[model samples]
Target: MFNWNLIGSIILPNIGGWAGAITTAGQMKNENGTAWYQTLEKPSWNPPNWLFGPAWTVLYCGMGFASYLVWRDCGGFTKKSILPLVLYGGQLVLNWTWTPVFFRLHQIGLALIHIFLLDAAAAACTASFIAVNKNTAYFMVPYLAWLCFATTLNYSIWQLNKDDGENYK
Candidate 1:
């Protein structure tokens, strides 16, 4: 028999993740040829722009599945499930917020701070997931690793362009 709840759980997070991506991409397009991101200095190790979509797709799916596992293990929104789900929800919001803060608002420093909070929230969420189901926590590992890498990249970008005060506008 099929588990529609599991499928729905997995699909919801992916929808949230992709919706943010689409919105941010639209905002980027509306820049009127300014291409502000291209003007910023990035670390040599920064991945090509083409990589982000695919990377985020995988990460979002993994996290969605992980959340479903946690939700299933705890038997829906009962008291036991509240903490982990709340942590997961908090981090997801932080995840969606970073792109606009960095790419649209051009607030790299603020984005860096936001990502640090995201890293902590994700780590806490993973730990909470482990308490419910250890195996499910594994699904979050790659996303956590990616968050670390992104934090480094955000920090590098901030350092490289902190002095370009006038260009931030």
Candidate 2:
């Protein structure tokens, strides 16, 4: 008989990741700060505001499923499995942190720092996932690529808004 428990086990973690992304994304200021983002000196090829949600939704789902695969392939919460999970969680935490610091507090500089760390964590997580499960590792590759782009964008905003010092204070 097919292991229904195994199937559900793999599915649940991805669902949890999606749920968390949705719950936390609720804190973003996409509509509230459209003017603020528009005023910034974004790249020539920067995507329209409407693109971010869809892109991130897909990426987060990939990360979530990758996470589940990594866990399952590594025999679930064992020593080998733990590292990837930790890295996954670390990247997710950093991902979740960026929105609040940038949109809510208006701390672009701090948000840039957060994004940089997030990029590093994501790369490491991808590496670990690849070591454990090729399919899972493949899934996170796009997310890592996007974060690399995002880090550059974050740096750009910090550079353009260098004069934002103490303005919100």
For every model in order, what is the number of clashing pairs? Answer: 0, 0
Q: Write the per-residue lDDT of candidate 1 for residues 78-157, one digit (tens) a residue.
A: 89999999999999888988888877687887898899999999999999998899887678999999999999998998
> CA shift at 29, candidate 1, in angstroms?
6.0
lDDT of 2 by residue, 41-125 (tens): 6667777666776787677767777887887788888998888889888878778767767765667888887898888898898
> Which candidate achieves the best TM-score against the true structure?
1
For candidate 2, the lDDT comes to 0.73
What lDDT score belongs to each candidate, Candidate 1 first?
Answer: 0.84, 0.73
TM-score result, candidate 2 = 0.77
How much is the lDDT of residue 12 in candidate 1?
72
